[model samples]
Target chain A: MRRNKKERQKQLKETIMENPFITDEELAEKFSVSVQTIRLDRLELSIPELRERIKNVAQQNFADQLRSLPIEEVIGEIIDIELDQQAISILDIKREHVFSRTHIARGHHLFAQANSLAVAVINDELALTAKANIRFIRQVKLGERVVAKAKVINKEDAKGRTIVKVKSYVHKELVFIGEFSMFRSNFTETGDKQ
Target chain B: MRRNKKERQKQLKETIMENPFITDEELAEKFSVSVQTIRLDRLELSIPELRERIKNVAQQNFADQLRSLPIEEVIGEIIDIELDQQAISILDIKREHVFSRTHIARGHHLFAQANSLAVAVINDELALTAKANIRFIRQVKLGERVVAKAKVINKEDAKGRTIVKVKSYVHKELVFIGEFSMFRSNFTETGDKQ
Candidate 1:
């Protein structure tokens, strides 16, 4: 594994490309080089740091991630996401989100935030909510911020639907929860479900 | 199985109270009486006809039914319902229901109609959505009316939750669908779910 600089740098670029999450220390250990040497080689290869790489994986269309709709289509600000795995987002409840008389956040606003997050977490060209089961644990008041988390239950089921579970919280208290069955364009059906 | 007039009238009222959807002919056959006699007995008992009885079962709290909430709490005008069974309602898409830019009906409005209908169909003093799965098949337009139907899937599960399914339609085309798990006040939890 002790190759010259040119060969090591070439392999280093390929390694980082294959696994963007590999840290500098791990890369150094893999190549039997110092962490500083690995860092220098990464700079020459124009590879970003691990944190940036993870962010890029979620934000950019690189590595076939984020192939769904544009981020603007998502209702809230997505702070963290890993395609086909999990994602988190935040939404500020405003006047537009509440009932005029009750001042309670509408259930569907919470649903849309969760639905769009589920769609965003799928690494496919098209992600649509075929079915969803959701509940409001408590009334969300106006001016409160709702934080939503989405986790993919199954990458693809036998019926060619991706299952995602979402939970929405206001101030760490559970306010809403939902399970979404997503239909992705990439999966082919076994010819039973419609 | 013939009875006196007073006894027949008493049993007729009890039968209608137990099952509001029962028809006059069915009641006559059950009592071994003529349809005319059944009608006379119902009249004497001040019990309304089958149609009115079904409506009263949904609207009034005469028989431990319609206890979840008042009819005013339901989002749309309820056309038909049988507690812990099935229900139907219609929501006219007005100016307030649509998004200004797209002129498309907001998804939450449809969900609210469905959610409230689901809550209405539960035969309990309190019904809260513990979870729901929903999907929007097509976007509703500004002027289109949405018809939502709710059906109780399970009267009570082992976890003491009632499963309700709802589907919304626009001009006979499916627009939205949802399956909700409702927590009811009357059904005591067997002590597992939260």
Candidate 2:
């Protein structure tokens, strides 16, 4: 059954919220409406385009949570983060990230996504990688969306070291795994150094 | 002492070859000429802008040497490489690579440069990372030029694994180091699968 314009607009907003990267064509097909209608509905809802939406989500969700580094420096878009606990990030491989002839995504990009997430999860003024052990399980192709999950495994306040494990998946299949030992500077209360 | 136009143009080409990312303003200062004169010299030499020159150098030097992947996939500009022996690359940390508020270069960018250099040094039809041990010795700042050198330390042909060590430096100061264990696929002659 087709939804009325009023109902469809409400559902359109929900759909975009669910998947920010969905295109106008896909939304029109799903809603059984003209592409023009979808565009008009988006304009009325004050929703930006896909790229802007991605940037906004990244900036709004995880920017302030970062203490050691700025949010813009993260290699991927962070969707969720719990300081000193866990974090999740998404990376979409584009043409520039892939080998020109083979269209295979470079392994370093996957490493970057995982490594940055591990650093971003720290709750300190400075987080640096002391050591990392990593593996690439499979080759990723262009246009693939990689979801990386990073968890804090251990923290040693006396030594000022934290251990984080990161795993990257493409369509639920693991592509890379890494364990990072991070070094953080000592900080005291009142925002002063120890 | 400033050379004449012809001599300066020839020296300009050589200078760019030595430092692919030299800016027009810097070139003008180095050659004791106006920026406009430097631009004209580049035009006569059929040289593109700084960005294009970097891209061209990356493409022209390493494109054909790659056996496992395309050169464009490398994180930095590969200036020298000897398959399974050694390789060197340069990465310039620009504004986009740094934290917006702090101007500190992201750690993952440094890791990407080192990790990709390790992968590019392997001589095989396919190279994948089995494991990597890495360390960030210090924080890198924006606009720093990082030179990463990768050397193959060991190879276990029977196990299909090669160990490579990469060290990255900014102005001769060590910033990052990594040891990578890479897996190579078995391939037969005549470009046939094993």
Candidate 3:
């Protein structure tokens, strides 16, 4: 009595959902199939590579809540978080992330990822970027895995402004660096009413 | 007596040097050639569209001294500047900018763009990004043309921290927003210099 491929896939999905960051070999062992079989299953399910899936799911759950938002120019995901004084995360870069015939993606993409992570820590639904001065030191290639790390340098409650610093590195080399300011708007007054 | 194509190209370069933002039609008329001919001249000179050329020239003049500096993540140039509490500037986005990748370039690119503009206002060489937050309400597309606007929100003299805010828009429609914190570092005391 053999189960249908659809049923097997469904089971696999559930298992992966339990822990989306499983290794291919582990998935193969659990499924009683070859690594190739597990890969095919993932391909059929449209699941990205392991790191990408993990990042995407993290972004969907805790990063920007705009997964359903109909805005263009969004494709990065958050991998980790630490609020307030310490903000940091790991991000993976891909070719699809870049516009056609360009050395790197637009500057905004990098800013948004780091900014979103910082916002997630703000405990507010509406946050605004106040100011930032950044520098680009290198060009990120396609499909290269990189890390985006940020932190809070200063805060002022009376003035309602916070200062943040972020750095993006490729293979341990500091590629891009930025310092930003974040303004947190009260969710009650903002349009993101629940 | 007829000027060869090379001579005409030289003249065009000089004209663009004076007014890089000149329209294609204006350039064509000035060169006594059709728009198509002028376009060909641009391509031969390795210059982008009118808007891109404007940004290129503006960035060149703005960061001329720091052009030799190695920055990895930034993609575009600072076109105009205004300073006060946090400082602000008008930046033009270019498609050829790096960070446009499949999953490589994140939303932070825009944030970094505005953030960098803010930091440039600082009369220091090295400022670190301490923390940042951002919201993605809209998406920026390739060749769509956008403006990055940033402002300072807060600063802590004791801690040497500054806060900045940034927003990106395509034709006045908000595309991305961000907040950042920058830390002023005096590298002179350190052994290495940026």
Candidate 4:
């Protein structure tokens, strides 16, 4: 069905908002239009590109939704967040993040970015990472923008540990996975330092 | 507490074997000798510097003790290992491991060196990391040599999951710590892929 340009443009805006990382080719395929038409529609709607949209979302979200840690402490920019619930952040790997011999992004940078988002999701005044089980599913290369999403999976610990699940991806491909155990400082009962 | 050079050099060899990361200055303090005297003693005894000693140990250990993963697959070189009991590896962070602007070592390399040691300590043909709980105690810097030790804490699981404890240090200061749950391929009954 061929919808009017106005209707198509409105739907396009919704689609982009739903998945900010969606590529123009994928959007064109979904909207049943040429790539050029999608671009033209996006231009007419004054919606910035995916990169700009991500930046806008991050800058806007970090101002109010973040409470557990300062914004600068986060390894990546928080693109979206709901404290004590879920948060999303993005990190762009550069020359310094990868091995000089091989362009694979260092694993700790990815973990730092994801772990920072995981730590940032707590609503408490201070959250300390108690534990994490993680895996590197794939190698991330330099220049790739990794998006990490951290969600609170469990907060029912009697000892006050909130389990935050963090998954980082290069676009849609899963690159790293981790579950972080964050402890609220006020409820710290962990004395066995092993 | 001061000893003659012959006696001190004999003890120094043993001390270096026990802790290969010990520096010349520390050896001097221990032997009540000047730093240059310690260097002269090391040369007389054909003892390599700390960096060379570490590389030698890793190469020697990898040739005989490594079983779970290939030598290349392990991120850092294994300096010492006792199969399913415990293992140690070393990673020297360089310019590639830090933020160009900050010079602080990235976190994942620390995890990788530890995680790899955790995996290498397992005696199985295929051991997969099921979970890891880790913490970064301090920011690592470029030019730091990270020594990660992994020891199997428990292997008594009915379902065959082994818990490995990994601790990474820079000159005896804790830089990173993790507890890794490794799943051997033969023992995997994990239908719940969460």
lDDT of 4 by residue, A29-132 (tens): 98788999988988999988878887776686686666666677788787788888899989999987765545767566787898778878898776656667
Backbone clashes under 3 angstroms, per model: 7, 0, 84, 7
Candidate 2 to truth, TM? 0.68
lDDT of 1 by residue, A1-194 (tens): 79999999999999988988989999999999999999888788888889989887765642244567667667787888899999899999999776555576766688879887988899887666667767777878899999999999898887888999999998889888888888777888544233
| Docking quality (DockQ) for each candidate | 0.24, 0.35, 0.11, 0.20
Strongest candidate by TM-score: 2
lDDT of 3 by residue, B58-159 (tens): 656656433212233234555555432443444454553323332212345555566566555554555545455556554455555557776766655334
DockQ of 2: 0.35
Q: List pairs with backbone clashes in candidate 2.
A: none
User: After aligning candidate 4 to the native by TM-score, how far in Å is the CA of A51 from where it should be?
Assistant: 7.7
Whichever of 2 and 4 has more TM-score, that candidate is 2
DockQ, candidate 4, vs. native dimer: 0.20
Q: TM-score of chain A for candidate 2?
A: 0.69
Candidate No. with top lDDT? 2
In what order do the candidates fall by TM-score, top score first? Answer: 2, 1, 4, 3
Q: Between candidates 3 and 4, which one is better according to DockQ?
A: 4
lDDT of 2 by residue, B78-151 (tens): 98999989999999999977767667777778877887788788877677676788887777888899999999
lDDT of each: 0.80, 0.82, 0.60, 0.78
Among the numbered candidates, top DockQ falls to 2
TM-score of chain A of each: 0.66, 0.69, 0.57, 0.68
